[model samples]
Target chain A: MISQLGDGFLALAQPLSFLHLVGGFLLGLVFGAIPGLTATLAIALLLPFTFGMDVADALIMVAGIYMAGIYSGSITGITLNIPGAPSGAITTLDGHALMKRGEGTQALGMSALSSAIGGLVGVVILVALAQPISALALQFQTPDKFSLVLLAVVTVTIVASGPLIKAVVAMALGLMISTVGIDPMVPVGRFDFGSYHLVEGISLLPAVIGLFAVCELIAQSSIPASLGKAVAVATIDRPRRRDFLPSREKIREVGLFTFLKSAIIGVLIGMLPGGGASMASFIAYAEAKRGSRHPEAFGQGSYEGLAASESANNAMCGGAVIPLLTMGIPGDAVTAIIFGVLLIHGLVPGPALLGENFHVIAPMFAALFMASIFIFLSMMAFGPVYLRLSQINRGFLYAFIAMISMVGVYASSYSLFQMWMALAIGVLAFLLRTFGYPVVPTLMGIILGPYLEEFLRRSLIVSEGDPTIFLRSPASLVLLGLTLLFVWLLRIRPAVKRGRAEAAS
Target chain B: MTRLLRGQVVFALGLAALNTVYASQLLQMDRPFANGEPGPAFLPLILCGFMYVASIIIVVGEFRTAAAARESAPQSDVISRIALIGPALTISATALFIVTFFYFGYLVSAAVFTFIVSLFFNYEKSGDLKRSSLIALITAFTVTLFGWLFFVKLFGLYLPVWEL
Candidate 1:
């Protein structure tokens, strides 16, 4: 393993691979800093080109993009209050507050530092525990897999901010969308609605593009531009490169423990299928607030809040890869595309992948670590420029987004129908958002729904239609218990406490 | 009553109606029940039922919340017509772009899409057509060129420049 790690580092040392890493990191940074664009879109746009590239190079580039993208989401959030990605939303709570207080440089610095710490910690844990975790995951049966997916689906819904009923509805809507094509088990069409295009169902790429990119265009159009003038009006001071570094006192205030705890939380969440960066940052941010000595300072530019969120989201990168590398499960959209990249190169991501292709996969690990370093370096390089990122012409930004999103969808599938599908989904999502429904749960529902149904039906078939089979398996039982525990902690307990408090008052 | 049966309430009803249709379709499918083996339609049927119940709960919740808010404090209920027009124009513009995308292909479609979208956002911000038009024209050309170069020239992704 050590020899393979050495080889991985050596491969990354090659000039061409290093260039790909730099290019991908820069691409991720640009996409992640720009509102309405994300690391997912950057990878999606790069997907077709991966056809010509070597597998190792592709993985290396993707690693760079993933790490840089997740970290850069906070750039716009800190400067503008518009999080470049949903993962940055939590960071924006404190990050934008700091920016409002004319400490944008300090906030960006702390964010970069925290992201580096989290990402490094996540990668270390990934290297150390990936094999063991995969071995344990391999022990999981069909029923257990169902319960695990169930745990993911329920937890995402519970964690989604809004009315629980609306979140469930959003999830249900996603599952329904996933069910549109042919049944996985029987190979018979379920809900084609008489159109041949419907038989193909909705592809993940178009759905993601429409939901995020297209919906963003429409959402931005709705808001008057006068609202954003406040950001421009704020007087920002020009700072030195050293000023981009987190102050020693600020680091002391945030403490190493908070960073470690948040990174650990991020890694654990990343290990779960469907546990994306947003959830990692959210849970970590909430925990930081819960455990803070000065909780009231949390939303008002607390450095600890920024550190907690940045650390968790970046750490999630390492955690997310664990399931993808060890098992074939992709934790989210970015990893899902990486799964496609592997398939194009005839490299399946499963238990055999590690044993057979450790040498080939090593550079990707190195790239992730290197990319984490770049996150900090990028702060020193572009910390000043990021403050002006929000001031980019809205006309150009939205126009660029609209072109890439629609064209990217068409380019990928070579199907005009898919582009239309993206538009339809985008409109639906825009309405869903306007009506106060959280869209992440919907995305999760679509991604996890097929697995949820397949495993459930397959388990039922194995047991001759007995429901008790779920509880019969120890692993499944334990997972289900965890699901219940999450519900209690995230949902029921909160409601009960709120009710009791209201009564007491 | 108009305030009580708001957009959310209407949306919930619409979803319930859609789910009912879905449920009926499931009933028409072969063996949706879990009697022998859970058929292909079984899961979808279950989902449809759940959606119906959830949508009903949403409507009820919205109604209750609206009632409580009304009783507690009455605020101005007027919503600006202009606010709705912006989103409408944006959605319609996007839909128009999709139409043009198929008929005109990548270059013309994207150029037009970007121009109109740029105009919309720019007009919202500045209310100056001269500035908005100049920026829109420049953006349309550059973005189109970038798309053509990146996807077609660099990556070899098939995006038609023009179509019948």
Candidate 2:
């Protein structure tokens, strides 16, 4: 494993591969630092372009984007009080407060430093555990695989923000979309609606582009430009590179223990299906506050709070990739799209993937580690530039997005029908968002639906129509139990508490 | 009904109707467990039933919430209308772009689509027609050129240039 990883590092050192990493890093920074744009969107846009690159370079570039995108979400959050991505929301609580206190540069510096630490720790743990976990996963039976995918589907549905029913609806809609074209296990056609194009099934590229890029374009169009102007009107002071370095005393104040603990919490959360960066950072921030010597200082410019959130969120990037590479289950939108990327390259992501293709996948791990280091260096190099990222002209930004997304879809498939499919899905997604439905679960469902169905059918066939096969396998039993447990812990418990509070009031 | 409730009900019903179509297609397939094995329609049949139950629950919940909101406070129609114009225009422009791209090909469709998109954003931001059009023209040219270079020259992906 170490030798393979060494080869991965050597691959990254090659000039073109290194350039791909740097280019992807810069792209992630720009996308993640700008409000209304996300790392998920940037990666979705990059999907079509991956067709032209080597498989290793494509994966390496995606790793750089994933790491940098998660870290840079805090940049705009600290600067303008608008989180560039959802993962940065917890950071904004303390980060913006620190900015108002005129310590914005220092806060940015501390954020970058802690994120690098967390990211390195996540990569180390990932490298150590990935092989062992894949070995374990290789032992999974059809029923066990079905249970695992079910756990992912249900957890993702429950964790999505808004009413649980709405999330479920979104997920069902995605599963329905996936059911189009042909039956996975049988040779019969289903849901083709009498069209040859429909029989080919919806491709992953257009679905991704439509869900993110086109949907974002339509969503952004509805918001009045005055809101953006208001954000741009805020006065910002020019700061030099030296201003971004955290003081030694401040570093000691946050402490190494806080960084390590938060990072570990992040990795653990990330290992769970549907455990994303936002949840990791939010839980870590709460835990940090709980253990703080002065809990009241949090949310009032506390460096500890900022460090905790930043560290955990970046670490989550590595953790999120674990299930994706090993089990072929994507934990969130970014990894779901990464799953598409790997599939596009004719590489199936599963237990056998690592044993067969470790050399190709290794550089991605190295890129994640290097991108973390770049996060810290970038703050020092672009401190001033980062402050002004949110002010880019909306006209130029959305126009560029609109053109690339539409054209990119056509380029990838050379099919005019797919372009129309993308636009139609985009419109539907816009409606889904406007009505308070979360889209992440919908994306997850599209990616995981086939596996969920195939496994269930296969297991039932072996059992001769006995559903008890799921309970017969110890691993399947455990996974189903965990799924029920997560529902109780994440949803039912919270609702019961809310009901009690309401009754008391 | 309040506009908010109306929109929610319409959207929910639309989904239910789509589900009905999907279920109808599922019925056309071989039944579940046909020939002593589960067929292709097995999981989708389950999903169809689930979607129907969930949709009814959601519609009822939305109605109850709307009734309570109506008793408590008046809803704002003006804000909703103002918020909708941009999306309406964007959707129309994008649909038109797709049609034109089919007939006229990439170069013309891309340039026109980008021009209109840039114009809408620029005009919305500044509310100045002349200035917005000028900036939109420049943006359209630059973006279209860059996209061509990136997709065609760099990636070597074939794009239709002039179908007409």
Candidate 3:
């Protein structure tokens, strides 16, 4: 295994493969640092191109994009007070505060450093656990698979930030979307609405492009440029290269314990089916605050707070891959898109993916580790440029996005009807967001719907329509119990606490 | 009624309507349990019911909240007209782009589509027609060429150049 992993690193040393990594890393850095553009969008746009590339190269490029994208989100968060991605929201608390204190360079430095540390830790853990987890998952029966998918769907819906009803609605909408074409269990078409295009069902490419790219384009159109310009006007003095390096005293202040603990928290959260970078960072930030001697300094330019958020979110990139490669469950949008990339290249991500195709998957693991080192190197290389990312012309940016996304859909499928589908889904997604429905659960629903339905029907068929079969299998029982526990802990307990607090007030 | 409440009610009703359409399709399929095995429509049937119930709950919740707000204090119901216009314009332009792409092929349609998108954003930002048009024109030329190069030349994907 170690030798195979070494071979993975050696493969990436090839010039063409190395170029793909650099290109993807640069793409992710730009997307992550620019508000309204995310790594998920970058990968979504790259989906079509992957059809022409080797599977290993495609996965490697995605790895670079994943690591760089998660890390660079905090760049603009520190400098501009606007988090480039949702993952950077927690980092923005202390990051922007430090920026206001004329410590912007140091803040950026600490963010990159901690992110590198976290990403490295995550990759190491992924390397260690991915194989063992795949072995465990290979033993899952039909009922157990159904239960696991159920846990993912329920947890994602519950953890979504909004009215619980709305999340469920969004998720149901996605599942319905997934059910449009041919039934997974049967050969018959279900909900074609009498159109052949509908019978072919909505492809993942258009769905992803529509839900994120088209949705974002329309949503951004609603916000006036002056509003964004107002935020961008807060400028900082240009610092020299040396100033971008964190001082020894500051690193010591943040402490190694804080970085490692936050990173571990990130990895653990990331391994869960619905756990994402934002949650990982938020929980780690809270824990960091709880464990700090100077808790009051948090959200007030504390290095400890910034390090914890940056470390955990970047670390989440590595941890998020474990479930995706081992169990075929995507924990978040970015990983979900990566799943599409793998599918495009004829790679099925599952327990057998590692066991049978470890050689093909190895380069991706290597790319992720290498991208972490590049995160620290990129900050030093482009520290000044990072501050100016938000100042890009909206006209140029959105126009590029509009052209690439729409045309890319056509390029991949060669179907104008699919392009239309992308547009329709985009509009629907725009409306969903406008109505305050979280879109992530909807994406999760679409991806997991087939698996959930297949496993449920298969299990039922095996049990001769007996519903209690789920409880009979020990693994299934454990997963179902976990699902219930998560609902109680994530949803019921929170609502109860909120009610009590309101009554007390 | 407040705009928020109005929008919420309309959105909830829309969802309910969509669910009804989906359920109608599901009814045409085999029953949930067919020949002693769960059929294709089983999970979808469950989802269809869940959607109807959830949509009703959301509509009721919106009305209840609106009633409480009305009793508490008067509030402005106006939503930003400018905000609505931006999305309307963009969506219209995108629809137009699709139509043109189908008729005129990739090159002409892409140039025209990118021109309009670039113009809309630039005009929104600077609110100056002449300068925005100049920038938009430059952006249109470059982005159109880049898209062509990327899809056709680099990736070896087939795209219609000038079908017309």
Candidate 4:
């Protein structure tokens, strides 16, 4: 492991790998610090670019983007009242308050410091835990794998931010879409509907582009571009580079224990299916407030609250990658795109990935570690510029996204049909969002549907059509039980409680 | 029912209809249910059942919560009504740009696509054609040139310019 770590650093030290890291980090910062843009979009746009690069470099660049993007979400939250990303919303409760109190510099500094610590801890945990988890997962049978994928599908659907029925419908729709093209098991066409292009099935590139980039474009078009006016620049004073460094006294006040605890919380949340940075940060912030001596200071410029959220959200980057690399389960949309990257590079993300391709994967782990440290360096060096990120021209920005998204789709597949497919999915997604259906589950369903189907059919075939095969295997039984447990906890329990309360009232 | 719930009801019904078509198609496949062996249609058939059930639940839920949903419907209705000028126009513009792209090539296609998008967003913001068009033109040129260099010159990826 030590030698691998050393070799990882050596690989990252190459001139091209180093350049991609810096480029990806800067790209992530820009995207994360923009209100309507996200790290997912950044990576989605970068997908085509990665097609021509080495797998190690591609993974390394994605690593830099993931770390920097998750961390930079707080940059705009501290300087402006608006969070640049969903995960940064929790941080804004205290961060914006600190800005109003003339402690913006200190808040920004602490955010960077806590993110670095949390990120480092998360990476260490990821490295220590990923291989062990992969080894255990390798022991899984077809039924067990099917049950596991079922758990992921259900968890992702139920955790989506809408009605349970709507999420289910979205997942079903995605599964139906995945059913298009040729059938995986039978080598027969299923849902092509007489179209030649549909026979190939919808690829990940268009689905991702349409779901994120094009959906964003249509959504952004609804708002009058003038609406997202930044806070008055004159009110906030620019700080010197020295001011961007968290003072030792301030660090002592936040306490190292708070940082470590929040990071652990983040890592654990990230490991769970449907766990995301926003949820991690929110839960960690709440926990920090509960544990703080000055709970009242939370949401009113408490550095501890800011630290908790920033640390946890950044740490989630590493935690999210763990499941993706070890078990082929993507914890969130960003990791979903990373799954595509792995597939594009001829690397399948599952138990065998680590044992067979540890050399290629090591550089990404190292990049995450280095990018975490770079977060502090960037915060100190370019604190002022981060504040002005939202002020970028909207017309130019969306136009660039529009061009790159469609062009990227075409370039990757060399098929015009895929580009149209992207637009079609975008329109469908926009309609779904308008009707209150969450789009993430649809993307998840599309990505996981094949695996879910293959495992189930294989298990059924092995058992000679007995449904009890799923329950008979110990591992499969445990996974199925966990799925039920999640449904009871997250869905059934809430509905039952609500029903009882309504009756009593 | 509220406009939102009404829309959802229609959507749910539509989805159910689509699922029926999918199920019918599945039945057309060879050995869809060959005894004991799960064929191509097995998983899809299961998914179709789930889709139909979920769609029904959605429709039923909308009816059950119609009163509560009505109170919140007006706010969203205003936004969606405004979307005619906002998203509708932009989507139409994008569709037009794409249709023109194949015949016109990358330079003209990209420039026009960027120009229309930029103009719409800018005009929506400032409501000044002169400024919007100026920004649109510059944005169009820069974005088009960048796409050309990056995809064509740098990465050497193929993007059809002009079939005509």
| Candidate number of the best DockQ | 2
What would the per-residue lDDT of candidate 2 be over residues A1-505, giving only the tens digit for each residue? 8999999999999999999999999999999988899999999999999988999999989998888888889988988888999899999989888888888889999999999999998998889889998999999999999999999999999999999999999999999888888889887788998999999788898999999999999999888776654353245567899899999998999999999999999988888889999999999999999999978999998999999999999888889889988998899999999999999999999898999999999999999999999999999999888888888889999999999998989888988899899998998899999888999888998999999999999999999999999999999999999999999999999999999999999
Cα displacement (Å) at residue A134, model 4 = 1.1
What lDDT tens digits, residue by residue, belong to model 3 across residues A180-255? 8899978999899899888878899999999999999999888777556435434666678778899999999999
Clash count of each predicted structure: 0, 0, 0, 1
TM-score of chain B, per candidate?
A: 0.83, 0.89, 0.88, 0.85
What are the candidates' individual DockQ scores?
A: 0.51, 0.61, 0.57, 0.59
Per-residue lDDT of candidate 2, residues B75-101 (tens digit): 222233435777888888888888898
How many angstroms is residue A474 displaced in model 4 relative to the true structure, after the best TM-score fit? 1.8
CA-only RMSD, every prediction: 3.7, 2.0, 2.4, 2.2
lDDT of model 4 at residue A436? 90
* List of clashing residue pairs for candidate 1: none
lDDT of 2 at B116: 92
lDDT of 1 by residue, A1-505 (tens): 8789889889988999999999999989988887767898788666656766888899999999999999999998887788988889999999989988888889999999999999999999999987787778778899998888788788778877788998899889889988888888887777887778888777777777777777877877767666555454255767788889999999999999999999999999998766789989999999999999999999999999999999999999999999888876677778877876887688887667887888888899999999999999999998888877667788888888888878877777888888888888888888888777988677777767888899988998888888999999999999999999989987999999999999999
Q: Arrange candidates by DockQ, highest first: which order?
A: 2, 4, 3, 1
True contacts kept of each: 0.69, 0.76, 0.78, 0.69
How displaced is residue A24 in candidate 2, in Å?
A: 0.5
Q: If candidate 3 were superposed on the true structure by all CA atoms, what would the RMSD be? A: 2.4
**Residue ranges of candidate 1 with Cα displaced over 4 Å:** A14-16, A35-58, A80-104, A232-237, A247-255, A272-305, A327-361, B2-5, B33-35, B67-82
